[model samples]
Target chain A: MDMDMSKNMERVMKDKQEGLEEWSTIIKPKTSVWNLYIKEIWAYRDLLILFVKRDIITVYKQTVLGPIWFFVQPILTTLVYIFVFGGIAGISTGGIPKPLFYLSGIILWNYFADCFTLTSDTFIKNQNIFGKVYFPRLILPLSIVVSGLIKLAIQFTLFIAFYVYYYFQSGIAPNYSAILILPYLLLLMAGLGLGFGLIFSSLTTKYRDLKFLIVFGVQLFMYATPIIYPMSSIGVTAKEILFYNPLTHIIEAFKYGFIGEGEFNGLGLVYSGVVTFIVLTSGILLFNRTEKSFMDTV
Target chain B: MSKVVLKIENLSKRYRLGEVGSGTISHDLNRFWAKLRGKEDPLSQVGQVNDRTAESISDYVWALKDINFELREGEILGVIGKNGAGKSTLLKLISKITSPTTGSIKAKGRIASLLEVGTGMHPEMTARENIYLNGAILGMTKSEIKKKFDEIIEFAGVGLYVDTPVKRFSSGMRVRLGFAVAAFLEPEILIVDEVLAVGDIEFQKKAIGKMKDVSSNSGRTVLFVSHNMSSIKTLCDSGLVMSNGTVSFKGDIDSSIQYYLGNSKNLNSFKSYENLDEKPGSKDVDLLEYKLIDKEGEVIDSFNLYEEVSVQMKFHIKKLNGKIYPNIHVLDKYENYFLVDTIPENEIPKETGIFISTFKFPKYIFNTGEYSIGLAVTSFPGSIVHFFENPAIIFNVTEDDLSLRIGPSTGMLPGVTRMQLQTKTLKI
Candidate 1:
């Protein structure tokens, strides 16, 4: 009877051991550079969506005009740009209406700037939450990108209203290429913003000086991208220097597609696309490496 | 015979001490250059053990070193240690909030950690919305939160203020709501830090009960870190003690507590009396030595609940005209006096010399807990305190089987002392 009881106990223990061995997760100090774990990110999609919603809703929760600030912000910036660049400086808008010309560039620039700034500050701003819980660290920056897109969609509608108003006033139809290249332009903008933001976020954890540089650097980059002045007005030497900037082609392409009035270079756009891809890939690699140890340093 | 659900192997974490940004870029570049040249990184060899009191000779220090343990299924493990003992570092590593420097952890199921209460709560968001946000941050799905929504509100007792902004809620209400959500997480493995100390006593009790239910009834594992010994003993099955970034002991909860309390200030029962300049005492008497001793006449800092123990005190007198008697004040862990033992004036000394006094405590006097002893030497007739020392020695008391039968299954009785009361039955 004793031997039989011992055998039964052994079998029960084996079953319990087998039950626990069915599912396990192993945590290690470093993961391979190639293992992006896209499936894990996909599993956490709901969390990503909730974060996006929180960012958008909480930004204007207490303001008197609430979300109307989304439209009012771009409208006010565009008015200032038209006065300062178009009316005061007599800058040519390639024959497009001044408001229409300036609002398009301002709206798109605001989206990129907002996305870049918010995403770049992810590691510093969310250190408390990150230090306490385990979730995909990428979710914070990805949600910032998504929330910035939502704001852009709202501001883009305002741009479209002016686009229609100018189309009748000038009787100039938008180029057919605008329909085909709009998605690509937006993708390029997002890729560049996300890429640069990731790189900056990872670097700033170690050295905080970059955090101060980014605010002024974005404004300086805008002048180089032909936001206020047309590309046709610049000399050959200045144009060549501006062509080296990946954003230069994207903005030029956006203006050509929507108003049918700027220079179009297929090779330059291809170069911009290639550069964006490289920057984004390297950015992700740096970000993954930093997320493992940023808490210790930050 | 339970299955091992979590295994940590040779875990270690090294950190750089002092300024975070001083020449770190040059260090990084130097390490990179050395790596490219196929040479050693130079800085990895100089790390010392994590001792904050010592002057740092190198920039690197090991926050944790060679930690290895296996936790079985449904086992509630209590981690107890002093500040800077790397308890939080261990939790952060297990939760994957930070990575270890040299080892790996294999866990069987989903792990959720409440390292801090209301970690990601946004003040601008309403209480209900903050619940969803905090829950999502803790790895719960939106649908999972929805399923437990009403229960969370009911448990938090904030149904009327659900729509109010979290900033407007009282701190107590916020803690209640935060703990309510975390308690309902239902993960396979739960890790809790010192978050339970935030709420009121009633909520703390409820939280401990819910933790017990989660581990026992649902067959989940739990890792709890706390400085509160009573709650740790009540909620945990086993315990791990950390000292100087290493696991000093791992065993059943009772002995672990004893070992932790005893070895906290070095393995010694005696504390040297020094620095009389700040002490409140008359120059007529000076305390020399104070310690607790077992029945074997050997120095001890811990005892069983029913064990006979003694307090040995040694003092010197510069001049004595009247009899000097010794009085011992026994205080509980919270410093509440429960007993005072004093000798008669005739039993004391009247001559000027060094003296020794031993006081005996019978069995069944002290219940299961920690007690600190204070000593006072006073004159006779007028009974003025010549010299007094508070908390001369501290000791721990463990529960005995005989005492176990006299109380609830929770292992403690209602009152402080366990007396031998007489009872009789009358024919009626």
Candidate 2:
């Protein structure tokens, strides 16, 4: 009986040894920080697209207006800005039409705001799904970015309608530089939103106080940027303070390119680009670090 | 020899107790500084064992400690433990939903986990849309989901409500849809955690059948964690039993279950009621000892179908104005009562100081299985229970030569009792 038991044990041991030899994945407490594993994210692109679709389709499902709310939100916000900041507050738009000028800034700002808020709350909002399955965590934030872009596209058409009206009536032609720098401006805004959002999302897992702060902080941040008023209208001291804000250059450059009347400093744009790169790199590092263990705290 | 699909070595997870976000930054910084100075983490050494009921000495506790296991290809491993025994934590770690604080796990092929059903299903989305969404969340590609979409809907039996919003469906329907998507997930390694408990009996049976098909036919590895012993015994080839955040036993299914049930205090088959004061009973009558004895009058917990057994109960009655009958209720492991035998009031003695009553069961009366006995003393033809002790004793009945004569039975038998029938062949 003892010999038979030993033989059984030896056979089991041999099977285990053979099993170990064919192992394909090594899971550990920590993975190399430098190994971003972008290929894994690529493989999950279909899931990312589906998530984006779900967000876009379900956001206003119960509302009567449905997808029309996407158009109504930007239009209503633009009218309020036109009246409150342009007409009532008497904020100058650098000789540009109030509706067109504010609409342009509103569309871009809405996209960035949506991306930032959604991405920053990724860990908290999607903890249920994240805690139950294994996927590239980056897909969640990426889906938000993509959905935000789709919203921007819908809102951008409204801005173009206003731009065309003013362009023919008031002879306001978009400068060549604006068309050339449009892609760069969009990239910068996306980078800044995604980067800062990921950082806050990672931090919020440990410190829940950031959740409340992010909602109010995003509003306060909008006022700091030259979204309501043109950069050319501010005083020298105020301009210097606003210049330090990375978004100031993107908004100002956007107005200068499209409407042909806002401050567009080459150095300021370069500074914003560099800051976006830094924020994005650090955000990704922090996000990756937090994704592995966020469920423990969440 | 089969290939190894997953291997975990020295894996451990530590969690902060009490508060969610208390002093994590300081602890993180302190660990960083200690590591920089070439020392161990100051906090790692202070964590206590994971005992939810006890007062923790430190704010940190190890949820899972030094867990190690390996799975060969096509093997179904059943993980069983009491609540808070780190069963879910082990599944989470294997699923990559959470990482360990120390050690490593090496695995091959795609690993999909169903920690819960309807994980990413949106209430506003239609059943069809949720299928795609939930499928993607489980790591299935769009084409893969599209290929199995009809089958998933058919299996869930929600084809009539395909276009309706998920919120309109019943909870069972939602779970069926969610489970259908997960069931169709053809990952190389599948991890399931108590999800089979959802839905009705028919749905559960279907889901269990699907899981069996997935593992047996596809030659895939499956890790199942459940409190349901019957399902675990039916579906798993090997078993892993965890206790106090560590592995207690790992072996073939029968022995692992034996060790797990043996170690569990509440589920032990042999229970002696030595302390009469602790046993629940009225002051008039108290139970002293209750046990299952064989034909030889020896106390035993296990028996064969051919062996006659008796349930003996010793009691001390202070005063008895009326005749009291001794009753024993026999319930299966699933808490389904099979029989209730009560002694006649005339048979019981009216004047009793210390009395012993034994209820004998003839051979071949009970089928081979585990049974629990609840003891009670009550007045005959009256609805009053004077002294009652629920689940006072537990025992198991195994198949002997007499039972094997009927035929070989693999799973649970069809009826409650196995009776011998006499037959004669008539030649025309």
Best candidate, lDDT: 2
Model 2 reproduces a share of the real contacts of 0.87
- lDDT score for candidate 1 against the true structure: 0.85
lDDT of 2 at A106: 85
The pairs that clash in candidate 2 are A19-B4, A27-B105, A178-A257
lDDT for A177 (candidate 1): 60
Two-chain DockQ for model 1: 0.52
lDDT of 1 by residue, A1-298 (tens): 9999999999898877675665467888888766788887887888899888888999999899999999898889888988888888888887778888888888888878877887789899999999999898888888988888898998889988988887888876677866598889888888899999999999999999999999999998888888888789889999999989988888888888888877787888999999999988988899999999999999
Q: Residues A1-298, candidate 2: write the lDDT tens digits.
A: 9999999999998876775576566788999766788999988889899899998998998889888898888789888988898878999988999888888888889888988999999999988888888898999999999999988888888888888889899998678856798889889999999999999999999898998999999999999988898887889999889888999999988888888888888899899999999999999999999999999888
In model 2, the Cα lDDT at residue B81 comes to: 88
DockQ of every model listed? 0.52, 0.57
Q: How well does candidate 1 score on lDDT at residue A281?
A: 92
Candidate 2's error at A283, in angstroms? 0.5
Stretches of model 2 off by over 4 angstroms after superposition: A1-22, B46-48, B266-428
